[model samples]
Target: MNLTITLVFLVLTSTVRSLNILGIFPYHGTSHFLVFRVYLRELANRGHNVTVISHFPEKNPPANYQDISLAGTIEVLKDDMPVEKSYTSIINTALFLTFTGKENCEVMVKNKQVQDLVHSKAKFDVVVVEQFNSDCAFGIAYKLKAPVVGMMSHILMPWHYQRLGIPYNTAYVPFHFLEGGTKPSLYQRVERVLFDVYFRTLYYFVTQRSDQNTLARYFDEIPPLDQLAGEMKFLLVYHNFILTGSRLFPANVIEVGGYHVSKAKPLNGTLKKFVDEAKHGVIYISFGSVISPSSLSHERVKAILEVVSELPQRFIWKWNNKTLLKAQDKLYTDSWLPQVDILGHPNTLAFFSHAGMGGTTEAIHFGVPIVAMPVLGDQPANGAAIEESGLGVQVQIRDLNKENLLAAFRKVLDVKFRERVKQVSKAWHDRPMPPLDTAIYWTEFAARHTNFTFRTAAADVPLYQHFYLDVICVFSIFVVILVGAIRLSLRVCRSKSPGKASEKKQSKKSKRA
Candidate 1:
């Protein structure tokens, strides 16, 4: 009777604590949404009522899960970004994001389904939004009168550090876009500082301004987007200190790095057979969803094929188009792959990747050494980190040739390199609580403490005050005044000394006469 009563009580308690969560992921990029949807689905599986608004909706969802699809409203990003890094490329990327953010915000707000929700008297415990290149979702969350939770698919954006009080000291901490690792030379550190300033300035003036204007068109009297971002109850960033070096973060900035990486599912029959039949293990090559493999130049493609043909190991390439390689026995091509399962397989030896955050984290988790050929965005930083961490080597795309590709493969396949990666993977998995559980716990915690404030005082402080520029200015002025006073006194003492010497000489001559 006591056991029966206890079970009933537990069930009642769970029912009482169930929450209604509204998740907004406006971006159309599959890679960005891929990291976000896992947690949103898990919320439903855990018995929370979840309504998701996004471009990609699940085909079938749990009974408690609902989707407001934004499909066909925006174009997907595929092979649209250039692989090269230059001044023009940087400006173009920034402008693309800025304009895209505004358009997405307007579309999301004007959506009929979203407008219905806005008009309805429904209540949500929390509103979760992706903290990517847009802040327009925050305004929607504000209208719902629910506490906000910000989710980062990757590391915090350069502008986020100041508001969230995450230490971004450029001396040792590298920018996401730069190829520099944690420990950089004098020149690289200077480059980091300059780029940091450039990114923040561009974001504030161009990106934020564009997003804010879009929000104003739809919502009246909405709090500033930056203010809304700062007021988030929790900011779950996809980062782990083991892979990313230790850094200071405020209490609200939770590190739920590998939450998207679920346990490896069984590979399909053909893939399993191919992987298992490898004589010398497998090399899995994928450039992620953003960069299509077909976009590669013929020369680069030929170089990759030449190197792969020379290798004894089997290769599985994620190619969206047909390939010219004739090694049917040694190569497998797939448009869509079970990446996590493939990486988890014992027969998988190494990963040749574009070093995107999603793929790089998975490589580290599986202890698979990487042959990183970074092409764009944060890939450079990730590639540099992979090399610095002894997990793999980075080959720049411009320098990618048969010889370089072969050498990179050789380096990662070394026993020492493989062993180091395994050790790091072990450390990565040694967390006290599972990343997903930590995320869920914090999500629920935010719902329970909706009235509580988690933002640091630094968020409330202005840039000049936060960096103590005013204090430095005062100290500098005092130092200059003190130096001037000392110089004036020294000049006066020198003049008096000359006069005294002359007077003494005159007195001596007069006394002698």
Candidate 2:
């Protein structure tokens, strides 16, 4: 009996051996950090030791998790490039993120604590890096001699899939930032191709070179960024088919869309009272973390407030400013609110959002329809997808007015929209396992299997060959040769006919003579 007990203990211990994981997420954006934090917390809960380097560190972390602060990065961004005025276009956003990402990477790698951890005898089994504007974090993986995994906050971009040798067919998969319905028109498809090419070129020449220089600055011997990217064993993408639509994904790519979403906590006293008193239901309004509603021009803010105040439903707006606008008794404003809990409330009718992926996913999770006011980046695409799903109506910020806002509210509040959202909520929750479990399982699986065999040969193929431009060139040459041969044969036949006619004329002349 003692021998059997000892054997059982041995097996259990082998099954749950703890792993050391290092996560590098140096971006200063709160939403980005939140997404990474979800997975880090999950890993810690599963008995893995997790160390995270992020811009926003947790005040009191769990026992198994450690947080390294990069708060200074935020101050640098605020001083150099103001959030409200910086990201106007796709190009501008890319440039801003690229520069800031590199700067943050340098700051983290050069920190005394981080440098000590790197040079110490401490070892990690795996390194997970956020694949945004920074590729410098890959140096940590190289230093520890550990396999690397990439974490993405939104849908996979062209460069993300291309690194895994996945086909980036722009004809079918629209660019992540483009705003269009499921069925793209001819012009829209052309525009998608152009946008894809433009961004891919920009990343390759500008962002990629910058990443290489940053990596070189830290590590004495490191592989090129492209080669290191291709060597990644797994990618955890924060997207799902419910909103993004179904598409082919490579074996190494895993979708954990709502991993961060959890059961709604009870609202605070003030919020609970306000929500319970709303007999006619509530319309929750928020523009998400980065873009404050108060940052809008006075005219725009006034227009929005006027429209919401006239609605029959009680309004709960997330206004960051201390001053409050005059409104009816039913209208309420707060500096911050528990968004997910409010969305899950039975009294919540519709959500006014910037249509960010995190907010959009939460609204879908709770069966709340949306009034999308997309500002920039992937917000427009998310808004378009929400509208295409028949669960929301999009209102452009520049075109905001009383009539348009009222129409959008009425459209999204219709019973059909509510029913559609419920259907989607059901489908979104029907996965075989919870998203967090799926993420943890894949992350551990990657740690165990350092080498991935599922990568496609397309990664090694030249660009010209991957797109079949060489085949087109060869086909064009063959067609030219065939046409020339046909023309030559026709000329020979005509010459023969003239020679035969002349011979016949000579014979006739001889006969006449």
TM-score of each: 0.89, 0.88
Query: After aligning candidate 1 to the native by TM-score, how far in Å is the CA of 82 from where it should be?
Result: 3.0
Off by over 4 Å in 1: 1-16, 190-194, 473-513
How far residue 304's Cα lies from its native spot in candidate 2, in Å, is 2.1
What TM-score does candidate 2 reach?
0.88
Give the Å shift of residue 474 in candidate 1: 4.3
- Per-candidate Cα RMSD to the true structure, in Å, reads 4.5, 5.0
Local error of candidate 1 at residue 164 (angstroms): 1.3
Query: Residues 14-114, candidate 2, lDDT per residue (tens digit)?
Result: 58668999998877777777777877987887689999887777787889989777776556232122223222466676666567766777788777777
